[model samples]
Target: MNRELVLAPPLAPPRWYRLRRQLRDAVLALPRYAALLLFGAFTVFPFWWATAAALSSDGAGIWIFPAAFLPNDPGLRWFGRVFYEMPFWRYFGNSLLISTATTLLVLLLTIPCAYALSRMAFRGRNALFVLLLVTLMVPAEVAIVPNFITCAQLGLLDSYVAVVLPNVAGAFGVFLMRQAFQDTPAEVLDAARVDGAGEFGVMCRVAVPMARPMIATLAVFTFVAAWNDYLWPAVVLKERLKMPLAVGIFNDLTGPFAVSTNLVMAAIVLSVIPVVGAFALTQRFFLSGGGLVRR
Candidate 1:
């Protein structure tokens, strides 16, 4: 008996075929690239316009045809005026203190709560989680009056504590962390326990390390919220010295610099810098989701 042998082609495809496939993929991806660029431009244009307005000599260029997007005579005078003419630094400091405090407090409260809810079996755990979800549905406006009264009774008005207290913890942070913890591999947790690690040790060493990305994501959200919060801060703080940038800008900048569009834009730019930087630092965690695990 005899058998015929068949020849096989090389592992790599022909050059022409590879080029054709690459060309096809590029052509197919054109619409997606176009959409991304369009949205990116749409998102970036406002910040560009604001920056141009802040830099413009008279800020009249912002209203002009093509100059609205491009400043006619860019200068740093408005930015200098932002500091000289108002308590911009004070507002910035207040916001920073409140936002930092709020983020830390929210993390401290949510981490243990989420760990317990995700790993521990307890009575009324489901009911407790449901109650938390219900809080998310309730309008924050509904709590404003009661919160104000509580703050007043505690004599915390016009202080950093007043502003930070209302925002220190939130149901959203707990829910996000709970979801992340629940996604962690149970085997890893069990291994930690088998090594003589208690529940607290397992949570601290195994669970938290796995959920670092979610924790970063929640921290960024909480910081951004606390930084940009206007209503609660405005309601609780009466003194200009304690007002965060969001509320201070509205109450103070609206009075004199309202007409000075350049100064107003400069102040806005300053307020936005911290938020953008914070997000930029933690952006990878958001993109990586729960996969940014520690080794």
Candidate 2:
């Protein structure tokens, strides 16, 4: 039949309805927000304690329960003591060089290897990848004895080379990069191949660009690992000047005559700055890169 058409403006929800919806959402989100806040506070407590201790005029009040959190008399004296009492600049330089070298070497080695694993068809490729995965299950500490002996045999002990060589090729990096490479679009890869691009060219021009976030994440991980490394460097590096910041602080500052909690805490604080700064700089890529593969 015959029908009449009528048009009407959309009506907004009542204010009470909107307020109720918002209140419901807030109530629903309360537990998640609470959990996050609790974990954040837990994570921050140690850094706060260390900073507080470093800023304290003396170490006596640092051990007390409530007093521990607040500096007795905040000042820069402990930080000053850290510089005067230790070869901090030398240690800083050594850590920086080693960490940078490690990051570069890891990227150089893992990218090609991961690309091959992800894109190239080869016999026993699955088996090889499985073996790499298996290596991830092994703790790094398990290899220290063999690494030390090999370093000694090669006469590379007490050097940055020895410190950096062991960590250059990591299964975790290869795995991470391989996963990222695997997510690259096959159509884009074929397009590259059709454009007179070989495997190396496709990887360099196409895959690498898309995987930049993952690469940045890997670089940050490698740098932080190399920077914070203590055990291996302590074992291999004998010379006072050769030590990285972590080893140098522990070895030089904890001696009987030099022992002071305030100075040690100050040194620890100084050592942590670069790591915090690096992560802060790359945090966006790091957090987003894990599951994201750019098209």
Compare the candidates by lDDT and give the number of the best one: 2
TM-score of 2: 0.95
Q: Please report, in order, the local distance difference test score of every candidate based on alpha carbons.
A: 0.88, 0.91
Residue 150 lDDT, candidate 2, scale 0-100:
100
Q: Best candidate, TM-score-wise?
A: 2
Candidate 2 clashes between residue pairs 3 or more apart in a chain or in different chains: none
User: Each candidate's root-mean-square deviation in Å?
Assistant: 2.5, 2.1
Query: How does residue 129 of candidate 2 score in lDDT?
Result: 98
lDDT of 1: 0.88
Estimated TM-score per prediction?
A: 0.92, 0.95
Q: Per-residue alpha-carbon lDDT of model 1 for 1-295, expressed as tens digits?
A: 8998988876988899999999999999999899999999999987888898988887766788665988768889999998898898998999899999999999999999989988999999999999999999999899899999999999988888988888776899889999999999999999999999999999999999888878888899899999999998888888888888999888867897788888888888988999999988877775433455343
Q: Once model 2 is optimally superposed onto the true structure by TM-score, how far is the C-alpha of residue 46 displaced, in angstroms? A: 0.4
State the TM-score for model 1.
0.92
